[model samples]
Target: MSRRPITEYAVLSDCRSAALVSSDGSVDWLCFPHFDSPAIFGRLLGDEAGYWSIRPDGETSRTRRYAGPTMVLETTYRTRNGMVTVTDGLIMGAGNRGHDLGAGAPGALVRRIHCTEGAVRVAVIFAPRPEYGLIEPVLREVPGGLLIRGGA
Candidate 1:
């Protein structure tokens, strides 16, 4: 299948694994628990089939960058009326910094967003896709968050 060229995306991880946050504010690609483990989010392959995303209420222009040499991503969205900025990154352990991707204890992907300029409405959607397109797994909302079952 053909894939849409991602206009922009950012990488965030807690050392064990990484997730890609799209310019639209969606976490399109992510591998949970371990980097080589089954992907918990895979919407990057199809429409609304995998992962999570965040975007403005409507169409808008966006710009993104890494915060210094860190894995923290700073994305700015510009609309007809105002602009907003989103900061996304994985919370690392003490004394750890940069895009090491392999220097922290297991942790969840942390996405922190802030409005830098003006007021802009944002939309958030979370849909996890596991096992690519082969298996249709079951979704369960656990205590902490959602979990997927099945897939070998």
Candidate 2:
């Protein structure tokens, strides 16, 4: 992946820490729990650092918007054959609102993709480099999702 200017990324925050998501649907940077915590994904600094992405299978134009009054982001991809939308956010704690939104953040990231028109193939990639990209964890398929393990 080519280096993207910082301006090309969207910011998702729990009000304490934030993530940088590229226009191509890649989450190139994120740190959990606190703003100064070690990054869980850090492709923003190097290609092999890590990244998570959700996009259409083929060439497509993209557009994005933030859900009203929230840090939630919705990115839409339009392909020659169909269209799909992916939503991304750093989940705030339940009941968090207004000045307290994220005051109790559960420290989780969420991504949801849906096809609203025609049939569009989707591509998903998940590569996590824990501890500032130093630990390349072992990944295994599980019943609900992939399990990532490594590091002491």
Candidate 3:
């Protein structure tokens, strides 16, 4: 079988945790509770697995930025009729300091989207992948997000 296209994806990790944000503005890779912990989302490896993605609906051009001297990223999409921007960042610890506590806290990925220029349609897709590639996974919808269970 042919492999899926490697769509553009931005990586966000705090040395401990990591995630991949797709060109379509979807977050396809994420491990929760802890970086080494089992992945809560792993759709990047396949279509049926992974986590949620927030993106503008319809055809659109994209752009991105980071919040100055930081690892934060801002992604912007401009469609024929409108524009939408997403601000992505990792939550900082106390005193406006980075999470330099040597792998202490679990990481959080934040995505904030805003409409600019004109109204645009946005979509959110949540697909959770518990396994990497060894075993098929089960996706369960939790109160706030999803739960992926399975794999070797």
Best by TM-score: 2
CA lDDT, every model vs. true structure = 0.72, 0.85, 0.69
TM-scores for candidates 1 onward, in order:
0.72, 0.85, 0.72
Model 2 lDDT tens row, 39-149: 878898787778898899879998999999988999999999888899999977778766876565565788999898899988889989878788888889976556665
State residue 114's C-alpha deviation in candidate 3, in Å: 0.8
Looking at model 2, how many pairs of residues clash? 0
Per-residue lDDT of 91-144 in model 1, one digit per residue for the tens? 655665556545545466666667766788888876666765456778788786
TM-score for candidate 1, please give it: 0.72
Count clashing residue pairs per candidate: 5, 0, 5
Q: Which residue segments of model 3 deviate by more than 4 Å?
A: 1-7, 92-106, 131-152
Q: Which 10 residues in a row give candidate 2 its minimum summed lDDT?
A: 142-151
3 Cα displacement, candidate 3 (Å): 4.3
Ranking by lDDT: 2, 1, 3
lDDT of 2: 0.85
- Candidate 3 residue 147 Cα shift, in angstroms, is 9.1
Tens digits of per-residue lDDT, candidate 3, 46-124, equal 6665667788878888887667876677898998889888887656344333445434553456778889778888897
**Candidate 2 off by > 4 Å:** 96-105, 138-150
Q: Which candidate tops lDDT?
A: 2
TM-score for candidate 3: 0.72
